[model samples]
Target: MLTIKRVETVVSMHQQLEQVPGCGRDCLGNCCIPGAKLPLYTFGIKQTLGSNKRAHTSSDDHCVPGDVGDFNDYEADDSPQENYFLDELLLAQWEDRMVRGLFRYDVTACETKMLPGEYGFIAQLNEGRHLQKRPTEFRVDQVLQPFDPKKFNFTKVGQEEILFQFGPSEDNVSEFYEKAPVLSSPNVVAINVSPIEYGHVLLVPRVLDRLPQRIDQDSFLLALYMAAEANNPYFRLGYNSLGAFATINHLHFQAYYLAAPFPIERAPTTRVSYGRKKGGVKVYELSKFPVRGLVFEMCNSLEDLSVAVANACVYLQNNNIPYNVLITDRGSRVFVLPQCFAERQARGEVDQEILDTQVNPAVWEISGHIVLKQRKDYDLATEEYAWKLLAEVSLSAERFEEVKAECLKAAFEGPPSDSMAQPPALPNGGSYNLLEKEQAVLIKSNIHKANSMDGVVPNVGEVGVEG
Candidate 1:
């Protein structure tokens, strides 16, 4: 219950007390983090990117690699041996916190069920998650905003809420620390007191830096590393830009465990090739889904994948276009969705029923996991209802094409070659082309089928969202 101002006062008091390792407050503020000890999880990467210095250069502002030559030729390394243990430790520590009553409510007791339909959207009835004070609202028209110290941020969260510190190791070997001194600007993984799903936590990269909720290469790479280290397909991470229902303008990613697959994950996707031959990053457009999104999957290295998506995010924010990103498929696949949900809501275009439900339709909801604040919505949840509501989140077909083209140009460093003007025929005798006006060239291969289930999707673990 400590305010940020109060925490600063306590920090000054502790500084005068001979620079103690930690104060009894057990928070992540300046008072306790200097020499505080926490469990550390270190991961290894095959390749490293450029310098971390923030660049304002027109070309490198998005932090894409200067050259990604032969990235696709690189051999894939198996998941680190330590990842098995790391995943277990993550769930174990998360559950231990649950036992300690660190969350706002018992999310496990909440009713959850999968709605009946082809999409099989999941719904949860968690009325207890309602915040006593409405979440602080940020200006929804702008995507980029300066970090305001007076506003709430993760730095004010208690140390007890943090699960661990995660970062890269010195070498190619994954390592763990039972108790390690906190880094000056550690990448902290902490619990979301208001839980949306089991094991719901926030990954705050370089917490002490107090970065505004804007995606850069380094922070996005850190998020990818976490996803890779966890090595669980069900353990997915997500992001929301300031205008995309992000109440707090702090830089953080939300993650949680859901045993079942998201409908968006199962949504059929078509490969959009700019006539590039088998290298670097590949982009796919979602087909037959309520929302129109571009999926980026790695063809080269994790760094390439992270940068490609980061570039897209930078495009969205720079233009004041709000968006959401879902990092799924064990960090291999990512969905960059440019949404107009908040914009529509502002213009009174969103239906009254949807507005009445008070569902913000952030990353999780866009991915087919609807968190209901009322029992009535949960009881009446259906695939048609879910589809219609999310349909409003999508940008118009023409606008999406414009945005997608720019994203592709940004992602690939330039527009596709003119030779790629025509639709290409697949080896399977199927031809892929743009759905309308050749906006995007789509291939029919690599389709993902929906998961088959009989009844309620058992919720054995926790997943989360951050705004």
Candidate 2:
């Protein structure tokens, strides 16, 4: 029974936070943002991956803030200079917020270790993130719930929690601002109060728009841009749909710095043929992994990959399916996981033993980084146990095949016109859409199952509950 007040404290913490520096109010709402200042990192739109673009520095005495440099100056291209947006800027700003005592807990101090096994599943015992009570206004069954302003959302968050305003520059060069006026609808990165890992933050796109927790093309691209901007493989971003362990209905993506590779990253993938021309986006299926999922890798540009994944996400949301997304390899690779753990829990089909542990397998968990609430579960964690836990989150073979066909179609062909604007039904009507829409025929040749790894079991595992 997650009370409204408790959830409010978790998301907003209005009571704990001090007054806003300039506005005297405590929140990032329109009232306090009129004159509030925040560090801004503007990225260059012309900078493409692998391009020999000269790096732009704030120290360029001739260049002023918000000024785009002359393109002719960068023609020399001695070396492919790194983008001005690097891990250091993100980390430095993030650390400053940490020094200001903005986070709810020191996630760096949390106990995290890799379980001994073939896959080496990572486990984090983060009791600080444990919340037994369900969010009152949250309808766990629906993926596209309306944004309830009365409930907790990012707008109610404090300005101090925000690291910087991230967006594209006016010209072809990157620029940083010491204190820029907060935009009315800027994409901002804020700290997750209950941090699961070091440098854990939430990328809230166009916070003022108050969009529900559903994927949009522009927002998804921003997430990819943030990942690409960091240029670090260790910093991965993840998304959890409403019913897929996303407690909040507001639109956001969770990201953190994990030096070690996720178990899912090491999983083998077989290419899926979408009948598209080569040199675009390639779709693949996870092989020898506990949770069944689809992987998207870019062959052309980030926009291509973002469109494919965003379309797949839009498809799941319209169909009322719960899913998780992992944006890895600096946003070049993405894993779309269609899950039924929440639906199974709702119907009481989940195992009692699994429910007792209270492990909500969200994006991180499904990606083989299970965050355990119990010390016993952490201590007794094993490869077999981790496999069994994630196996339950995956859709059954029959359902997955059907979903895969539809998602691939959505990814390559784009979502259907009729279902594009369809809003999700209220909880009273039940979450799953009963009315059947035209289904995409499953192309058997498109899917190829890869060989399972040695010592790995072939059986599917099913178990689910809150984490």
Candidate 3:
């Protein structure tokens, strides 16, 4: 069991301790001031306080001093409990809980190396076998299969396949649902049966929808609420769309608590304003490493968050674009990635085998951490090789510019007036529509100029698109 304790300490020798800089008070708020007693507690790490003599030394030299009093006067509740701070810090005692079970897998099993050139880093995940074995050849007609409650079981809770009854009426029922969940209400949060990382979790809607696009604002907000409840800076929340490498058809979002930051988290980002929604939710764009995507930074208002996400969903649905979304707890930042680039790569038209894997670009892969299942793929994985793979899976310069333009246009003018707008043609001889003809015309003209000057298109894996 992991036990974390915070102890209070003070200076024993008044003469040995120097007065706090710029403050006239002593170790005890105002020990030198007669007839005045101000209680102040100095919290320090238990490991640092070596003996009883050293325990009395001031933990922070800059802390203002106060009058010495009975040590018991400062002793407060030391009972094991969980405390979540506003700064995304979590303090918890795991002595009485089964916290040891949470870390059954070895985190160090995955190998990470920074690739050369533009590919930031690649994590050769030997534990990605679960994802590789998932069914990827579902028939188009069977894409939206109905839920079967009899087949559903909360196996993690128990060995028995417990059945769940959704509602009083037979018609108002769910075929399958999680009987035991970590967090539940309109949505359910449960531990992933096959987690890539320790404490990896999934947030799914109770109503049961195959596609994430079908998730309503209520369910979306609930998932975000559950993520915030984690309160740990290590955990990051994200989602993959239907065709954007989501293995399960059920509408769900994923969360994982990592000891270290993902490459994307540390990568540099350039921010650009995409304007604000009618409800005042500010929409923006973050480009460069990680993956280029539209961002919606929400305020405290739930209504504003709904509006921002609703607009983004409507835009993608209208354009027939599959996408992935990620929500970071730190800044309340939402990343919306249209899977145009990934979809193109899935065709396997290119001969490039660099960082090739069975799975397509998903939320984790787009976030600069590509997982390799095959031994050959893992062996060939390098920084430059990883960068090339991501570049191929990422939106091209021209396509990205068009996407940014459209998002900004939608933000200012409101959700598209036409929800039935057909996707435009692709640059290559394909039916894929990433932009409208007129928009493509302008983008192609700019591309032509850049290509003419350099004899090759700039940012063609050389650099990323500017925000």
lDDT of each: 0.69, 0.71, 0.42
On TM-score, the leading prediction is: 2
- Tell me the TM-score of model 1: 0.77
Candidates by lDDT, descending order: 2, 1, 3
Per-model TM against the reference: 0.77, 0.79, 0.56
Clashes of 3: 16
Stronger candidate by lDDT (1 vs 3) = 1
Candidate 2, residues 423-442, lDDT tens digits: the string is: 34434453221111210011
* Stretches > 4 Å off in candidate 1: 1-24, 47-82, 132-134, 414-467
Off by over 4 Å in 3: 1-122, 127-132, 137-186, 207-213, 276-278, 300-303, 408-467
In candidate 2, how many clashes are counted? 8
Best by lDDT: 2
Each prediction's RMSD to truth: 15.4, 15.3, 24.7
The Cα error of candidate 1 at residue 372, in Å, is: 0.6
Which regions of candidate 2 are displaced past 4 Å? 1-24, 51-81, 131-136, 276-279, 422-467
Q: What lDDT does candidate 3 reach at residue 2?
A: 32
Between candidates 1 and 2, the one scoring higher on lDDT is 2
